[model samples]
Target: MKSLFKIIIITVIFTSINSCKYYNFTGAKPIDADTFQVNYFQNNADLIEPGIERIFTLELQDIIQNQTSLNLVPQGGDLLYEGEIVDYRITPMTATADQRAAQNRLSITVLVRFSNKNKEEDDFEKRFSHFHDYPANEQMIGARLTAGLDEIYARITQDIFTESVAKW
Candidate 1:
């Protein structure tokens, strides 16, 4: 009886492992897609920050690569991601008693066009955005700026990933 139970357990594990192609714990099921492509995300915002495009492009690539079992290809992939930075700006978030700015919000928005060759109905174009707030006294530059940008990019990329792949 012990030997039979062990056989059953092994079979269950094997079946679970092979349940689906490109199955992952992140709730992404890429179906028959074996490769993906992320084209350069150009920064077209009026207030462009140098290298912001590169930062966003690389981070998106990294997230998809880390979360899915798909090869990163230069182009013509089963899954494709291409977009442009549409907005990058800082606006006053709060005002002090003296009528001076007390806090500022740095917001970034991206327009993405995602294509799934294997699933034509699944292709979509969407806008993803994120923001960070800082004290009005602090200049929106240097390390603080980089940190804020990084945080914003992380959120945007995660949203893109969740939409393009994660069914959840």
Candidate 2:
């Protein structure tokens, strides 16, 4: 009885392994890009931060590496992503009907144009926006605004990843 149980277990294990589904991902489809090239995202807007370009480059590289099987190469990729920061602004949001400023909102927007070099098609082209709210702080408001911008950048990066790597 014990030997029969052992045989059954071995058979089950081998069957499961053999029946594992395999996915054939060729670069022919619009969503199945084998390689990607990310250019340095520039800030063309009047409002600029010192390290925004670097932040975007690093974030994009990290996302592509983690999310997809696509090869991250320095040049000559199947897909190309290039864009710029189009807008950055801050506005006050009112909590009361009287329009008294209760919080400040920092917003950032980026325009991404993605293309499949191998298939000769535009994969995605759109603008992504992200924002953050900070309560009114009289002291060091600039610092708060900068922190808000950082948060906005992080959100923007995530959106870009979802569109590019996640293929959504």
Q: Which candidate number maximizes TM-score?
A: 1
Q: Against the hidden reference, what TM-scores do the models get?
A: 0.91, 0.71
Q: Residue 120, candidate 2: how far off, in angstroms? A: 3.9
The digit string of per-residue lDDT tens for model 1 on 60-144 reads: 9999999988899998999999999999999998999999999999999999999999898989999999999999999988999
Residue 30 of model 1: what lDDT?
58
Specify the poorest-scoring 10-residue window by lDDT in model 1.
18-27
Tens-place lDDT digits, model 2, residues 39-116: 888988777767767777777777666656778878888878889988877678756566667887777788998877
Show where candidate 1 strays beyond 4 Å. 18-22
Q: What does each candidate score in C-alpha RMSD?
A: 1.8, 5.0
The lDDT per prediction is 0.92, 0.72
Residue 25 in model 1: shift from native, Å?
Answer: 2.3
